[model samples]
Target: MFSGLSAFPLTPMNESGIDEAAFVRLIERLADASVDSIGALGSTGSYAYLSRAERARVVKLAVEHAGNVPVIAGIGALRTSDVQALSDDAQKAGASAVLLAPMSYQQLSADEVFGLYETVTRSLSVPLCVYDNPGTTHFEFSSELYGRIAQLPNVRSIKIPGVPANPAAAKAHIESLRALIPSHVTLGVSGDASAAMGLNSGCEAWYSVIGGLFPKTALAITRAAQAGDMKAATRLSERLQPLWALFDQHGGSLRVVAAAAELQGVVEHPCLPLPLKALDGTGRQQLAVLLDELELA
Candidate 1:
């Protein structure tokens, strides 16, 4: 399993469709930065908006451009069979791992959740990363649910979100889970603002959104912390304060990446599907400030 800051880049899109050249350029640029791994077609990558064919194309591009770095394919789907099929495609595309988020739908029993992972894992040749982003799912994994998942054979890691406000509580939850689960089941963290929280809490790894635009900054934070230099990590993360705020102010990571991808000229138009607003004029201004501060331009 890979560790450190893993970035999820937004897919480049325009009026016609995905911009192949621009997408390649973005990946090449990211590879120059210190990313431990790259995750594609994730929430930050706007995976839900793309068609099945488009998703495969995006995953293929990411894996090819990633070089020696590990690739985590986000194969989240609405149906169990669809998810399993996507997982199979990821393995075929050379992804080292795949992320599975339980999609929103009717109330799910524990058996269904188990079956979802079972079906997807049984169909795949590679490890399956269990993604639990409750904000979108409208359902959180209880410690009991995670305990059940923790025992599964093909399960690789659990991508968990930070607890509200209290780092101690978050640490306690993760520690409790880790003690119950085997050491092979890694605990991956989301939300870069809480990254320090995750690291301090003994999280082995993290998945990043800001890394899509500022990979160096994300890597710096993770590296500095891993080296036990808290001060350097704090200052480096503080420099990325604007991007974090942009993620929150814009409703989520998808909007933040879409907006930044446009400002950086990495993608043409940077338009998103319905329900997610592309960068408005003011959002564009915020993006410019974000890039200018990072010296990305």
Candidate 2:
């Protein structure tokens, strides 16, 4: 469950609330593509915006439709008590593991962050993935913090951010962190654009956003890296440079992927929650052209 491509699908929504049918379609799409795992409610799934009940439903639906593939549910919340409650919900829903990013409104100290993981891990029955997403949470983790949290009972994987672009640097970076955590804890890489480089550099898994919508394409890169065909992995990643550029142009991947999902008719137009708009006409048009050019349409 921890070592391969874990696809994080969008939790499509409508005026009537979650578009259950569409969400199911996305899950089945990932499952049919034989992704190693299904990550429900990561940042891409809009987990933080949804209510606890909504998150529970999303994980339940993911597990139900993911066939034999494991489901890793995101349970990040601002409060430790709430995180504990969310963790309970995920475990009850049959999540194979739970992903957690230390979300906060006020800045948290290193001790506070460690305390959060320590408190939550005690109550957790399923394995936990440390979600070190500094971009969204605005809380960067030090190597020492990672070592502390990873020592907790259920810590099975640490989802670190992107690796350095240079191959040697990327390898050294991963190796430095790898030495800090226990060998039982696998290191998974986020940051979709650098996924190929991270995997080729020795990371064990790719916690991917693009894989959610285009599992086969992402799986190709993962397979290449796993087979030690670094050239093939790099080539595949370079080929998707246009798509990566859209992620940067649009500020982040959530909106661009939402646009792609709409263009593909996999979800309704304007699928994101309020205050977060879909790509504008110009952005959508550019995305549509790229999708066709890249055969992703």
Number of the top TM-score candidate: 2
- How many residue pairs collide in each prediction? 0, 0
lDDT of each: 0.77, 0.93
**189-267, model 2: which lDDT tens digit per residue?**
9999999999999999999999999999999999999999999999999999998998988888999999899999999
Candidate 1 backbone collisions, by pair: none
Off by over 4 Å in 2: none
User: TM-scores for all candidates?
Assistant: 0.92, 0.98
